[model samples]
Target: MLDLRSFLEVCKKEGELLELRDVDWDVELGTLTELLAEKGGPALLFDKFKDYPEGFRVATDMYTTVKRFALAIDMPPDTNGLEIIKKWRAVDFEPVKPVEVATGPVMENVDEGEDVNLLKFPVPRFHERDGGRYMGTGVAIIIRDPDEGWVNVGVQRVMLHDERTLGLYISPGKHNAIIREKYWSKGESCPVVMDFGPTPLLFLSAASHVAWGISEMEWAGYLAKEPLEVIAGKVTGLPVPANSEIAIEGEYLPPDVESRKEGPLGEWTGYYGGGERSEPVVHVKAVYHRDNPILAGTPPIKPPNYAFAVQVRTTPLLWNELEKAGIRGIRGVWEHGAGGGRMLTIISLKQEYGGHAMRAALTAAGSHAAGYMSKLVIVVDEDIDPTNTNEVLWAVVSRANFEDSVSIIKGCWGTRLDPALPPEKREKGDLTHSVMIINACRPFYWKDRFPPVNRASEELRKKVIEKWVNEIPLLRG
Candidate 1:
């Protein structure tokens, strides 16, 4: 419901935002962000860099908490992850096309030709081992399909190459990469517009796995229940969010025409998984920004701490996919942040018949949402909460049979970011990996005879807590 600036104001009002002055951009700012995110700290608004002018700022950890994420999508700040998921799933996905405007705040300051300089802002190096300063960690790279004429706004890591150039790296098989390749096949540079500070909903849409041909901008608008304002880029003629902080109009040259080394930067997988490699470069033609631009940063740090505090969007997609595949009795679905969200998934379901858990496990292993880069899929009984790692592990150890409960799905969809992917396979461009599905439910045949959990019944526990909560203050929680 709110734009980027207004969203920050809301966060500030909720005491979820912190403004830091004069932090070093090279590593200090990034290190601070990492530490804060690991501790579930507030969103950081960094200003007054050593070499950059004041008001030229970088904001990080904006969605590193469920409340912040909920606020971003116009939900009540107190909404939990599952509630957010259910709310999202209830939405109708009809595209709400962005309305084009002649000009807006982003046009307040413009730089083109020789005047375009990217270093005016404080671009963080993010990691000690990073190859270069990155400006697109929390960016939306807009490109259109040449043949279909459909637009796509997707998130990809961008490394600053020079004053008027950027190194772009889209993961293999992604919609953006697919569309770019279509242009390359025609021997033409792909027109591009990079939005450094898109609205939170737009950023979420860019980072999501929206189906091909469906514009992310429209999807974002549909989610917001309104149309986003857009302006055509002066050079690329591509749509840019009129209210965004900074935008770069450019073209991604075909790899054969122009390329540069990218990555060795820290990834969400907690590893420099892609390493340094040659990638296509975007030759910036025009740059536009508001008077005091705010660049959003979502640089990936180690596991258990991701760009988003919770993987809110994808979990629902996975759940819907499971349901669509006819897997019933699914009580909960959770993608763990420890494995960069996608590598490990837990599903809790009510076991109705023999092999029901196994069926759900196999289906989840290949489902559209959980199919990629997935390492493990664990199926647990309804008694176990999928979000509680300890409870899920207890179910696995207590109920699973090694010979029958475990099954490996080899050569499933994966990515180069998989740290466990062998060097040999990576070199050969074999990005596929395996997934292990563990059915952790009690044996269906004799579930009635299986050992019962020692925990008290829910009715007794609730009644006792309600009766003695004031006396035993700890029970109040």
Candidate 2:
């Protein structure tokens, strides 16, 4: 099993890691996530922050690079994310139970009560306008099923409040939210473990909540192709990765009893929505970490950022799942850049009949974990690549006859994070929007063949490259 320590060793060997020393937390760390985004830079390691000692560090941008993405998926150097997704589709996963470890690096230090100071770590203020230092962007939160005796893990953001408390914003769609809701419903606090510096594989597995009754640690083993090693927590019964650099054990209290403002910073949607409603308060029970721990994070905002990479790798999985729904001839799918990867989806398919394309579009709109928020669904012919914006535009202009080709529906759908939606809809209540699907395929019911295209042949391209590559040295990487 690849533990957290071994994962860090691998990242170091790949020449993709950077260590930042004595960085200030108030604005320094937030600036770092942005600078790296601007440059498409490597992952960072902040060794020291404002009040923290030199030992604690924060790691960001680990999943920002393609190489890191390749590593997380266990693909070879030459393989891209699409190739990895194809492999994932072919494999039949077998869950491997975690191996219990008696001792590990995560136990090197244990702090409780007044000594538990979250500010002592290199927790970053991710954006200049953020509410406070956010310590939980890249962390995996662990929760247990009430009746099944199974542990579930998922990546969620947490806002650090003070030494003894934090603001937990568990999305209503995630397993952590359900677990916390169960606790709050009964007027009891839910025991939870937040692991900040676990293996990248843990975060990858945790990002997707497993089906009901499925253990996420076992799913981690399925992805790693080996068993994972976990250590039981000191206060919470949750099992954390044995080699994790930092683990915080806590409980989520009722929102009415404990709540506070959590954000006004850049969200994954790229806009700073005023801020999320006050979340429930978490009472920290214990903090455990290895010596010289590294805290990893990604300040979410806009396209080409952390959420984009996640959507690029994961949203495509929905395509495979849609095909299993008996939909056929799926060509390509793209979640547009605007929605922070959650709000918009565009698909190209070879439609078998009038409603096939619309069926595919709706499936992509309402699939699992998408939070029911698809702003627009555009469907085009198989000849077009959904990833190419120009092709999508061309299909829309050339084939969509507007009145005949566009299908618009209006009613209560999932429309979260859309500022344009009415206040009642943006709140817990559902919002209504005119959902349109532009059938950009040729009128095959009327015409037999599409207009021909003019392009270079594969043989001609190969001959041209063979002749000019050496002559034009700039053409070679």
Candidate 3:
């Protein structure tokens, strides 16, 4: 089965992983990671902790690059974000329920009751303004629907409160919060299990925006093409990866009365102060890990955190939704990698008739998966690559007249993390915000009247390249 170590080894063999010894777990570790991430560095594995033993390590930046993300889902090493989405669209995701085992590596060593010390791990204080150290990056939080009997797995920004407490910032209406409320409403406690590290597909699945009632475990297994090996948590009975690096089983506590200040943690939007609040705290009952466990670190400090993973998971779903909505000829759909796959979307389609592109634009803007928090939707002709910003801008500037190509509708679906929303509006369930639609495609009726690009033919371009390769220096500095 696909595990974290096996995935890291693949990245290392491909020269995409960078191993470092004795990296500090304090501010320096996060600073170095941000610098490297901004510079497009390789995956980092920090071994040789200052006080801890050698086996306890921290891994970061696993999904920052396109090729690394490709490796996560078993895609070819050279696949790009768009190509990965196309590949995902072509697959028939056979639902493979996770196989449960009696005992597994995660249970190799267990710290029960009062022995649950979250501080023992190398949880880093990433952003300077972060309330405290967060240990839940690249984590899969498992919670079951008390009524529906369906389990949900998700990754949220979680802060380590103490030896046996973690504060999670689960947004309103999110799967985890939705499931947790179902129990609280019935005067019951929500069983919870938070695993710090799993195979990349598990994390990807956790962070995806799939349809309601679809558990991330099924998505993980579908991506892996086989049932993932899982084990029941001692406290929650929820399924967790059998070979997880670190696992923490707990509950949201009975009566759901406990509350703690969490967040002000940096979000995927590259903004802070969006999620700071007094949220529900997870009371730890047990902690499990391997002998020399590696924590997968994926703090959302800057842009492009796990971009290709988001594209692969969301683009295909959006395209399918569009087709289901009867908007045809959708050549491709892409979510910007740096926007964390939610804020912006682009689509390219062949114009079947009048307002075909408009229909596609509205479909994407109002669709379930991508509509929420999606600020802009740009629809281009099939000839343009929707993923390429320059080509999209060209379409916007050349083909679209400013008056006829733009549409703005207020009070649309919005995100709580949107910094633009006023403070009063943030409260009282004012999640509704505005959205923009940019029709960048050419006019449907006057297609023949449009101007053609002056780009050279491919045959002549290839001939010129050959001549330059044989005679002149290709790059004459």
User: Which candidate achieves the best TM-score against the true structure?
Assistant: 1
Question: lDDT per residue, candidate 2, 1-477, as tens digits?
Answer: 555555556777887677777777777677876778668777776775656677777777777766776666566656675665565443465778988888778889999877898877767787877888788888888888775678888887888898878877765556677777777788888888999887877787787534556677887787777777888877887887877889889887788788887765567766665365676788998999998888878678566565556665455566766776778998877766665666666778887876787788776656663424566778888989887878898888988778888776666254344556667656656645556667777765754666665767869977888889998977565
Q: Rate the local accuracy (lDDT) of all candidates.
A: 0.88, 0.73, 0.82
Q: Rank the candidates by TM-score, best first.
A: 1, 3, 2
Q: Which structure among the candidates has the greatest lDDT?
A: 1
Clashes of 3: 0
Query: Per-residue alpha-carbon lDDT of model 1 for 71-101, expressed as tens digits?
Result: 9889998898888888666446788999999
Clashes of each: 0, 2, 0
List model 3 lDDT by residue over 15-86, tens digit each: 998899888888777777788887778988888878888878888888877788889788889887667776
Segments in model 3 whose C-alpha atoms lie over 4 Å from true places = 253-256, 273-275, 304-306, 427-429, 455-477
Alpha-carbon TM-score of each model against the true structure: 0.95, 0.89, 0.92
| Model 3 poorest 10 in a row by lDDT | 468-477
RMSD of each: 2.0, 3.2, 2.8
Residue 446, model 3, lDDT: 93
Between the candidate structures 1 and 3, which one is better when assessed by lDDT? 1
